[model samples]
Target: MAADDHEFGGQHTDIKLEIVEKYLQRYSAALHTWCDAVWYIDAFAGTGSRTVRVKAKEGDLFEEPAPEYVEQRRGSAKIALDIDPPFDRLVFMDAKPKHIAALKALKASYPGRDIDVVRGDANDLIQKEIKWDGWKKTRAVMFLDPYGMEVEWDTLRLIADTKAIDVWYLFSLSGLYRQAARDMSKIDATKERALTRMLGTDAWKSELYSPIPPAIDLLGSLEREDVRQRAADVAGLERYVRDRLAQIFPKVLDPWPLPPKERPQRFSLFCAISNPSPKAIRLAEDFGRSIMRSR
Candidate 1:
């Protein structure tokens, strides 16, 4: 893939990437003994490795000598491909056509590997079209990394409902909540739908806004108002998403109890583990705590 063709984020994202690589490595090893064929599915897989400009900042997960453009980091697609004992099957889906072409090229690069590339909405494709005949027996690991709050809650439910798959989700809190102004005067229609899809319901309106005003009087702090308190803040919203996932997933693993105060604009990596094993607990609890303590 061309250098400019992929999605770009801050160098801090590599911390999350390294966690993903570590989890994939340990997870596959632990399950390979019992499962016959392990699978890796990336719903929002980028072209491959993208560019990340590294700069020192507070709550930074990665450290570097100086602020420079990073090139050694590979995207999820490449990292998963390099895992030991490797996945039996690899599935990649992205809404962008260019990303599909990029994946197709990767398929050409590795001719013998079993890789399926689909171009469409992952919410529908993963739920309806993707065949899980082998998945039920061997098990699967899915990575859902959407740009904003594009991933639907029901899609998460469907994946967790399998009882075998484990998921790593990047829930973008800053991107979604910033869509609406601080005031409750006006709301964007498209953002309204996106928020509903992300949260699984319109309950966020009542949770985030105070007094829960009617549609006609959605103006100012008089009747319908914005909650200026920390209770309606971004951290609160992130926690709410995790709580929603806990209802379906038996074990919801997150490194932080709340959003990091230093990087409020960044997304938090959440691991929704199903059918938790001993290794899973160590990875989520022990490892997660150590990582947070280091920060």
Candidate 2:
């Protein structure tokens, strides 16, 4: 996914949106001063608005359904466009035709702005198209907000290899919890493939899908308890992913486990900046500190 690819549900601080807006506002100002062009790339970008089903309260309607439907929120693409002193160019990518059509319509709303809508898998398009050009003397922000394990590790490595873009990745820790079966051997093959893709390795099966050893009881020969260690939040996944990111990006700003309200069940936004400046570092650290304070 290129941009605005968040899954809708429950309550949120809307911090995810806040983070994007803040970063863009800061990034645009910084880039505009020096860089000839700045690009905003949103992969896995969803349609402008999603039709959400909301519970209808009492006295709400003449004959409203129990769950009322409404188009409630603006997607990232729209939000990014709305930012003042916007990026010099914007790129939107998605696998859905409807989303592509929506993006095209969105393009119409801002007639003169430079925007490109690539209808295809974000992983492939990013590696083949976006990453290849527009990066010379250009600073770019790529928001990879996929709904699932659509972002491949190889693509990330490629981005790092270029070392010209900043990445805002939505890591789905909840998906890991779902696939991390207690009995690892019995996990479905398809899910296993997804886990491997997300982790960029098959070793997670051995690394994370294991039980915590039993502690010694009063009787030395017998174990005290059978305590099975499972995926709880983003500990295992975060460490592994961040370690990999560290190998590439010098600065990986993860205001991780994000505050619960903004966190999607177990998902969090992770940022990887290629070659960060002092101001970028300041903004990233400030954001993390703010989130921690709120927590």
State residue 255's C-alpha deviation in candidate 2, in Å.
Answer: 3.3
Which candidate number would show the highest lDDT if scored against the true structure? 1
Cα deviation in Å at residue 21, candidate 1? 0.6
Write the residue-wise lDDT of candidate 1 on 147-180 in tens digits.
Answer: 7777888898778777778889887767756764
- RMSD versus native structure for model 1: 5.9
lDDT of 2 by residue, 1-295 (tens): 2344444633432567667767777677777888888889898777755444455755555854454544457777887888778778999988988789889999999989999988998888867865555566778888887775678887887877666788898877677777866655557899888878777788776667556676776767656454444454456666777776777776898635545554445776788887556765665567556545654
lDDT of 2: 0.72
Provide the lowest-lDDT 10-residue window in model 2: 4-13
